[model samples]
Target: MQRATVERVRVAWTRSTLDDRRAAGRALIRELTAELVPGADLRIEQRCPGCGGPHGRPMLPHAPVLASVAYAGPWAVVAVGSDRDVAALGIDAEQERAAPDLAALFPLTSPPDLRGWTAIEAALKADGRGLLLSPDQVRLSPDGRATVPDGGEFRILPVATAPGLIVTLALRHPDPGPRPTRRP
Candidate 1:
């Protein structure tokens, strides 16, 4: 089975503006997909599953691949993989040392602290439901595995790319839906 891969690009965050970070994310997506799925006309689309609007998780329609993007502090991360390799993929990154109170709000999971939160968010992302699914519903193990209370299972990889930025990439359990049907 093929596997999804994630790449991160350092960002020059300015005044908490996300415009630059978002552009970097799209660029990362293009770079990752270039070698994986060559010659496919890729256009990132975000359609909220809840309301079918245009502001949701980023996706590459009709590209024979799955993609996800996340940003944390000065980093913009993107994950891309062939649709056949994994069901779905989601990524999330956060500044671990930047928030102690928020980190303490949730009990520690496998990776512990903010890393655990990223894993949970990654899983929720792969599920394509986002926060619509309660974080409490997801359970993570130290061995790179996550199980949602009644949803899809995922394999998670937690990485400490920078001194304080933690990024996690997750893949949903096999059986990606029929490609043509799902927009993602």
Candidate 2:
């Protein structure tokens, strides 16, 4: 079988509401799963990191592939990867604005450049803690690499996006496979 790579969204998700976008995103993921990894069972799971609620990062729990979804206005993006290759992965999209203010939002770390900020955000998302994880704890060097504290190292890259949109992709290498779950 040919090696699979992360699949990015081609068409924009035109849903007006979050609920609609989420459902549509999952459907797209299901289709992408069939095309990307043939014969693999795809089950999308979303459990909040802070709480055990069902509104968290969309992922394939216990499955060999990792997935993440992000939205910006009317656009929704999904990213999928094989757990054999990606320990963790994240993708994010933000609409570009003039002189955006993020320092007030990201107190621990605020990158001067918009692309850098998106890169940092992608790494944080890959770390799985998202905003809960302080940006200061993330280590991003001159290279397009970031090491998350107590998490996997990630490679952040810019993804081609539509006009007025800034999209970033983060992929954590050397996935150690699924952790053993207690029978509790």
**Every candidate's lDDT:** 0.70, 0.70
Q: Count of backbone clashes for each model?
A: 0, 0
| Whole-model lDDT, model 1 | 0.70
Candidate 1 residue lDDT tens string, 64-111: 778787777656777777777777788888876664354333446333
Which segments of model 2 are wrong by more than 4 Å?
Answer: 1-19, 98-100, 106-110, 175-184
TM-score, cand. 2 vs. native: 0.77
Clashes of 2: 0
Worst-scoring 10-residue span by lDDT in model 2: 1-10
Q: Write the per-residue lDDT of candidate 2 for residues 1-184, one digit (tens) a residue.
A: 1112333322223344665777767876666676657876778888998988987788766456777777776667777766666677787777786435777766765554777777777888888889788766777778888888888688887776567777788886774669999996
TM-scores, all candidates, are 0.76, 0.77
